[model samples]
Target: MKRETNRRSFVKLAATAGLCTLASPAVLAGSHPEQLAENEETNKIPKKSWYPLGVFKNPVLESVFLFYVGSTWQRLSDVGECFDTASRIDEANDYSWSDQWIKTGNRLKVLGDACLKEHHEFTAGESYLRSSTYYRAALHHYPDPANKIVKELSLKVVKNYKMALKLMSIPFEAVSIPYMKTELPGYFFPAKLKSNKKAPVIILHAGRDSWAEDYLWVAQQAVKRGYHCLLFDGPGQGKVIRIQGIPFRPDWENVITPVLDFLKHTKKEVDMNKTVLMGFSMGGFLAPRAVTVEKRIKLCVANPGVLNWTASIYNGLNQIDPQLLPLFQAGNYDLFDQKIEEYMRTSSYVKWGITDELWKYGVHKPSELIKKYQEYNIEAVAKNIGCRMMVIDGTGEEFSVGEAKRLYDALTCPKDYVLFTEEDTGYLHCQPGALAIAYTRIFNWVDKYIDVI
Candidate 1:
């Protein structure tokens, strides 16, 4: 069949990408864009704007802090140590967050360098992973789209990730997945796939605006639990967006389908029937959307399940002006934009949010972004998902208030609705603060259905 040829062809092109070396993070990340694309947005969301998430008072700071804290089980984060640095940040200063975090990252990188020189492989790897994690937090609020510091910190993330990979006990590969006109960057942890046949494969999909390395802890957990894992930067994410300028597309089945092909071709021992599509954050939307069309997956996990991104956007629009949604629906775009522009002048949250969404969606105007997101809704095809589904809802979801249950209610297939309360550590969107409990429940549910043998 046509799909068969695509699978074989991917392995051929992907093999030429070669196994990346520890000294070559640039090659692993990908070549630089011919000319950097312009990012018109600025980080207008002020410190402590919306603090509903957890721990930290600011939403951005809370998310970034948990982005580091979530990895502590793998030794990639030191929660107590981070709290020390978190205290030194000056909320009145806009750049204070990145400055303190990047400083901590720099200190850890120096420690890693000395440990590597002393031949303490384990200690060096820990230092490198922790350093990479801190650098990642800094990137979240780092301003100036054209600043070289963005690229500098990005490369540091990849470099330290590679360095830590060198010291890992399991096999790790810096892989490239061939897509439409280019390749997608990925990490392949084969685990014991070759010797232990029938190994289940977990494909971890990153959220909007996140790098694969940002969620390396997810792959670490999967591999630790005996699953072959793949973490990749798809269109409009990580290097693909920054380096290649491809924006996000709604038909994620087009992306997930090819990834399945690549896995089937390369890892002969993997149990395709036991495949689990585990999505994080925005991936809650992307994963369910992909499963509606891509049926090869046997199990699908939507953490903080989202039924519709456009609906969520409309929710914000409604609050701004009860007439805003009606204006958009009536196609009065110029007037709608005029009103939105007026609102953006005063609301940092609205300004940064709309600007960030425009950049990620790769559209010039907010109207176009709305049209693009319209393709991302899963209501029409919810029944098309043939695989087992688990919809994860959280206690403190700032963006998606009731969307998870909405998705659960819409699905006609065999499904379960999971609520992550304060007790479950599934407090926020992806349960970054309580990663261990999140992963434990997820995999444990899979154990009940999938036969390892």
Candidate 2:
């Protein structure tokens, strides 16, 4: 009832926008040559834009602030404290910026420990989560996987997250699901239902660079709606890849099938037939791909639907060199890797994007990585999806701007296309600043199509 009221208020203030619908099979065949050329030209030009400053310089820091908007407002973080700490960092120097983040994060951890000692459990829990968030923010744009500071901060993030989990209000289980030879780690948050009746479950996963902890805010929203939420670190994700060396594979069905098996057999509280699969960022591609093969999923949602991983890779690569494609197809990976590394050294954004992919894909060369991404195309498989689907897109999304429309057109199953505009304060990746509005629309759709209770 409260959420419904909030949704109505939001809808009243938000402007209605048209969805970019594409249904032609010919257009889905491939990216048009003319459009590719235009995209190449657009990538070559760096446009100056105004992003919120919050307490730091540059759009990256502003994006970070927006990403944590829900958490900060919910008291998981002290907004003033975060801003004060961020203000001290020298944003121009990556190493210095990361170091300041680590220092601030450590200070927060100490404060959290002090709060625990003083018998302030709620304060301590919130502080630990905030500390982990800060540590993760430190690594956001820092490219090198081998940097000792990066490794140290990553470990600290896990440590603080685990500490916070122990003190959270709702019961959460740190679970290890059987996957391949090794295990995949996850957190399962069951709904606090008074009855023993089965409840619908939502399995949430993150993109290439996001960790499971980053999804807590969204999970909390789902839990409030009486759904059990499972957030996991699959292959090539979070600690699984960062610590265990499991590279990403295009066949996410293999990964998600096992998770489904675990839930069906293990979680008695969950309604297996009502299970929904949701993925954010790169998971947009991964989730839909899985749902095509895994029919047990009742519903699927892809935030900014990704139809082709190859196109996504090319979009990022085009910023560096359009000639790189021939090198990839020709198997001249050694030269390609060298050139990419050289380009990475000059551009922080490129370095972060490319290096993260290389590490996650377990490839020594950019060409090899691109070759692996070629297997992740979903257009060929989209027609096979049996469940209802939702594709969300933002009008101002620069990365994969046309992807949602392409993916929507390819899907033959019952589907809904929702577009967020600047008026809704959600025309950014994953609607970072307007999650409340985003979740309202998402869950409302879920309730309409799927039985929630």
RMSD (Å) of each candidate, 1 decimal: 14.0, 10.4
Candidate topping TM-score: 2
TM-score against truth, every candidate: 0.83, 0.83
Clashes per candidate, residues 3 or more apart or on different chains: 0, 0
Candidate 2 residue-wise lDDT, 1-453, digit = tens: 653443322221110000111111111222333444665798943332223433543344455555654457445566676667667777666566567667778888999999999999878888898899888766765657776666667788888888887876657888899987879989999887877788889998877766888878767877888889999988887778767778888888998999999998899999898988998877888899998899999999998688986785565454335676677667888888786676656545445556666777888766677678788798788899988889988765544668899999999989999997655756667776566788888888987888733
lDDT score, candidate 1: 0.71
The deviation in Å at residue 316 for candidate 1 is 1.4
Give the per-residue lDDT of model 1 (tens digit) for 1-453.
653443322221111111000111111112112111211123433222122324554335555566566667667779776887788887556568788889999999999899989989888888888888888777665544346786778778888988887875546889888788788888988755455567888888777756787666667677777788888888767667665667788889999998999888877877787898887777888999999999999989998788997786676566445787798899998888887676555434345445656766778776777688788798889989988888998755555668999999999888999897644546556776577788788888887766633
Residue 268 CA error for candidate 1 (Å)?
1.7
In angstroms, give how far residue 168 of model 2 lies from its true place. Answer: 3.7
Provide the lDDT at 65 for model 1.
65
Candidate 1: regions farther than 4 A off: 1-57, 193-196, 347-350
